[model samples]
Target: MNYTLHQLQVFVKVVQTQSITKAAEELFLTQPGVSIQLKNFQDQFDIPLTEVIGRQLYVTDFGKEIAELANEILDKVQAIDYRTAAFKGILSGRLKISSASTGKYVMPYFLSDFLKEHPGVDLTIDVTNKSKVIQSLENNEVDFGLVSVLPDRLKVDEELLVVNKLYLVGNKDHMPKTAKETKEIFNQVPMIYREQGSATRLIMESFFERTKIKVKKKMELTSNEAVKQAVIAGLGYSIMPLIGIRNEIYNGELQIVPVAGFPIMSDWRLIWLKNKKLSPLAVNYLEYVRTHKADIINKSFSWIDLAQKAHKH
Candidate 1:
């Protein structure tokens, strides 16, 4: 059987996305073109690699094995490109990253400087929840995964990028101004919660467990923005990352409820699979983050201090 690396690349993306249309879009090729390449690649082996059921694509068992091998081949090719670019004293390549939904607020600030400095590097970011982000890391689909909570089950390397502090927030008119008052009002007030599998939800649950406080959960929403809007409309209270609610807090649409043991802190980490070999681009990004973590943290969270001051006045 004979196939080009480009065909393998296309096939791998098709499997990753589970949709030919999405794969085509990412590859910047027409759907029919991607389909033709996939057909040709499969014909060489005369085996079914994928099938569609109920409008959803599913990779065959054999396809899973092929995808694994394809990933290995692609990694080696990327390594060669990285090494060549390094020898030429230039850094250039696509850098794929996955981050938890909440990281949507934080990662861009950290990534902005890197993108500006390494204009040759192409960047792709997948904003998803914690579970999907970890799945991408485990599959070696991304160079890095940004999350506040590290999975205990995955063997991975992690770098602490910053501290993520969560604040209990609600509509200004509904929120109590002091810790003791908020504690007394907790069980009586309806609480809007992030959906299951959210890092913020997990952290909030852990906080509740530790404090022995029970919440009257009224609604579950999929995104931070949704939860924020719900709280703004006076539906309920929510524990949200300080990064996500700074603007709302500054504008007085939301106020941090001074709940006991407020600002539950967690470490925001950049993670990658431990045994996976890093390409030069990945290595450079890791080093850049490590060397400038302090600056990244200060720049990212300086608004928190300002927001607090604004809230006081």
Candidate 2:
């Protein structure tokens, strides 16, 4: 019944990945080293923690239970560390944010300076789809949420940060040569789409529906990056935010093709429940953003303005 934290970590990782090789790779341990740690961990337990059959691995039901407990223990241990930093007069606590997936490109710019100044802050950022971002806000699960579109049903206050411009993009070699009507262009090249409920997908859909245009829908992908890759492979074109694909445009791998109603725009917003109490850490982070957002946007995000100028009609 005795095991070290190291053993618990190895066992938890093995349970999570269900593969010795993947656990080892993620933990930066040699495969043999991980195997030995796992074996040592299992030695202290009575019942089976894992099983192998036909070269596939499965964690026993008991193993899943242990892994969950071990994860809780690890989180408690990290909390202790954060508390220690607080005792030393450093700003310490959790600063958690759940962001929509495309927000991966935007949130870091806003967070970097604050995080750099407060190294004691234990930061947790979850980059997920739009619904999950809203869910996290509704449940009070995170200190903040980042999204380009405000949820109609949520009673939340938002701080506007930056402009998010979505454009019709395709692989440079595969796009139409001249500007065409929105519906015609969509028909000329099959439209790659983000999965249902994605904000960008809604924008694209509503835009076409309003214009009374019918588009040929090809592959439906779950993520912005996935849709971009599909377009780059010449499968289809998609509407993508410029923030996420600027490098591809600069590299000539992708192009922001011109159409009549070209750039769809939204504001990137930091949102939280209207009446929710904020932790001191969250308050400090918000203040930093309130004061520094403009400066950060001017300094770090000037490239966005340059990209916008090119899209101007």
Best model per lDDT: 2
Task: State the displacement of the C-alpha of residue 179, model 2, in Å, after optimal TM-score superposition.
Answer: 2.5
Residue by residue across 156-189, what tens digits does model 1's lDDT show? 9999877787888889887654445356668767
Mind giving the per-residue lDDT tens digits that candidate 2 earns over 1-313?
A: 7888999999999988889999999999999999999999988889989999999999999988989999999889988987888888889888999999999998999989888999888789999888888999888889899999899899998899989988898998887865465547876878889887687888888888888988888889999999989988988888899999988999988988887776888989999999899998999999999999989999877898888787663
* Candidates' C-alpha lDDT: 0.87, 0.88
Give per-model TM-scores: 0.78, 0.89
- Model 1 residue runs over 4 Å out of place are 52-58, 92-98, 120-145, 149-160, 172-180, 251-253, 258-260, 271-283, 298-300
**Candidate 1, clashing residue pairs?**
none
